[model samples]
Target chain A: MTDTVHSDSAPPNGALPGTGDENVTGDEKMWTARVRRAAMRTLPPDKLLPDRQPSYVASWIYVFGVLTIAALVVIIASGVVLTWKGPSWWHVSKVGLFFNSIHLWSVELFFFFMVIHLWGKFFMAAWRGRRRATWVTGVVCFVVSIGAAFTGYISQQNFDSQWIATQAKDGLNSVGIGAFFNVLNFGQMLLWHVLLLPAVVIAFVGLHILLVRRRGVVHPFPARARPARHRITGAATVPDEALPSSEIETVLHKDPEPVR
Target chain B: MIDVVSASIVNLTHPGHYLHWGFIQLSLANSIVILAMLAVFVLALVLPFRSGRRSRR
Candidate 1:
């Protein structure tokens, strides 16, 4: 009975006809298709490119994250120019020197803003609302960025670079990583600075941002003031004397809940 | 003393080596870069968000 049913329903091209319930249960079953579907569900277009944010998001503290991203853009653009011109060109030509300066300053700005953002998030307890992954990814990005910056310093091809490389080797050697890292090798440091570490940092930052968007911003602390009570005469009043000291204390100490 | 103070000011304005200790050197150009970075960081920190209104709970 089964063989007869299969033979009768099979199409000439051997492709199954779409079920009417295709919308309810998608037809595609390949791994990539499944992943794509899951990704779309997890990060819908509207959520990925949100038109609005919670009112609590309108804070100056949130601006440093964006500023750090802006500095990263500058750093990458200047880095590309520096890489295209080669190290000697930057050391000799005025145009190269200017671009090099921009690269240096942009990195400085990136780290500075990143540190500020890190501190702000720490103080805000940004890991709240199951956002531990986001916080961890951010910290990993910071660590990777330090590697990128260190490699950049070693690649500078100047007295400063020379001194830093010589000083850093001892620390690396003490940790037994120097055998592989070889800070004295300019070529290796240059590749790590320009290509490998930046890629890792970018990947981590992308994950961190995705998690942030997924979790939404954590809410600000709730106001401590209590609502006024209505008296028998219909006058609103604070009956502070009547309230229990412990209850009042609990209300004052209550922390804000995570924003939906 | 006046000459030394004036020279320091000139060094700050001009891009040249201001401090040298053994092989390590700190130049006015490097100092300016550091200052610019600090300025950007501070601005991002203190700058008002959207129409200068503070966010309220």
Candidate 2:
């Protein structure tokens, strides 16, 4: 690879480098460079982590996503401690039980905040303005989180878990994924609960957030919140005095296009 | 053994505080949670947020 780097750095035709050896334009010779270029193109530092959010972001509805993320952080942290102590320790040890309780409530609040966020975004048409991918990812993450939480239930190492697993096994088998995802197996379920599902959830969540930052939050319905216009006679389209105070504030604090 | 925290108000472990509508039967706790979530969602939409700070941009 090193030998080809200098030789193939500048190919005759400037084809995309990742498209195989056929397109090794000067900068694309190295995979690192290609990756760097792609990352820079897709998520320049500002887009990936912008310092300023659009003014429309100032809403309690907007905070739910952040709250959901916060709950997930607590869930993961408490889950780590619970895993370190092992499952049965929670039944006998106070500290383990405390962490276990924290994990449970955090999971509940996570779902709670996430569902509210989903509702808020749905009513607002979050898929608007080329954000369908972000919307889809958020929905997929919700489904994956359900799976993660289900596994946590049946992996709890109690009669409750046992009953849940027993009842769930037949339904899973009917779907033909039982062998692949055996709910009755405590160890398997625990591993999945702590490892596999969390990884998928986190990865999808990261993608969802990056897409949000990339495309920007969806705007309000165009009809409902059109920018106040001005007429040729120097009169306002919607008189400033006629509008409600709150609506006026929303209109006056216009923001730059988030899609940029 | 009992949970003082949850049982103090009502015996949460005992079932029967539920709403039954046709084929749908939901526990009071779940119904309350769903109602609370809906309420919060509405409040988030309607409440005035603190946007007093001017945009630095």
Candidate 3:
């Protein structure tokens, strides 16, 4: 309930009482100590896993956010299996083929839900309430995911991969970036697809979700049923002077409820 | 016996050779990918978002 820990309740100088670490150091300069403090302040456990949410958050439009996360989990699980078995295994083994299919389908779902989420946020003006970082990070994640998908197509080691690489190389060369991003290089593409791009994507996704947790969900648009207007000294105005005042008060006082 | 087993396993594992749809031609692998994508789209459309009692705080 309280933001600051009281000195009277502070644990013994050399141990973290609540953490159950008997040999903990109380040094302020410790890197792990600083990180823990920062994480606790920025993303408290209650915010990370909420039990209730604003009433307006129950809309169908919000579902795509969780759907995208679900698809990402499936993609990562299948990707791990693919990495363990290697590229050629999928083409030869039924088990590998099944996993490969799961990966492909999951990617498709991920993009589908992600696009819907992006559009929903755009229409909702999700950057309102100083949440620009959340919106920007989400957009960056989407852009990087495209690169991940491109590298994946090139690393498939099949006819489609061969054709895509050959076709993409010319485009890359025309832009004069082919010297660095050689689409024809299978090994390079494989590394980017499996390791580099995914890392970047995961990092951005983590930041995006963290920002969302910090900012809470944006409120729904105010109700549009305006009161009837009447002529007031040659100027038409709504009769209720308290409406805008009430709206401002609601916006100022409302806190986001925990997610259900 | 080894030959028969190998043939049967290949038949089970191999995605068909080609898929022709009027103006379109796709390898079996590509066809499978396309089918999977379609299935995902359908799932997105039909999947329910809410479960149990839908009370709000």
Best by the TM-score measure: 2
Better of 2 and 3 by DockQ: 2
True contacts kept of each: 0.28, 0.53, 0.03
Which pairs of residues have clashing backbones in candidate 1?
Answer: none
DockQ of each: 0.20, 0.39, 0.11
- Candidate 2 residue pairs in backbone clash: A9-A26
- What's the number of clashes in each of the models? 0, 1, 2
Ranking by TM-score: 2, 3, 1
Interface root-mean-square deviation for each candidate? 6.9, 5.0, 5.3
lDDT of 2 by residue, B17-53 (tens): 8899999999888999899999999888888987755
- Give the per-residue lDDT digits (tens) of candidate 1, residues A1-260: 11222333434232234321123223345465566667776887778888656655766666778888899999989999999999899998878878988998898879878877887788778886577999999999999999999999999999889999999999999999997999999889988998899999989888988887887777654334444642221122346455455544344334232122
Q: RMSD to the native, candidate 3?
A: 8.2
RMSD of each: 9.4, 7.0, 8.2
The better candidate by TM-score, 2 or 3, is: 2
lDDT of 3 by residue, A200-226 (tens): 999999998888888877765544544
For model 2 the local lDDT of residue B37 reads 96
Residues A14-97 of candidate 2: C-alpha lDDT, one tens digit per residue: 434444544433535567766766777798888888877766777787689999999999999989888888877987787777
lDDT values, one for every candidate = 0.74, 0.79, 0.75
Candidate 2 Cα outliers beyond 4 Å, as residue runs = A1-28, A224-260, B1-3, B10-13
Question: Alpha-carbon error at A140 in model 3, in Å?
Answer: 1.1
**CAPRI-style class, candidate 1:** incorrect
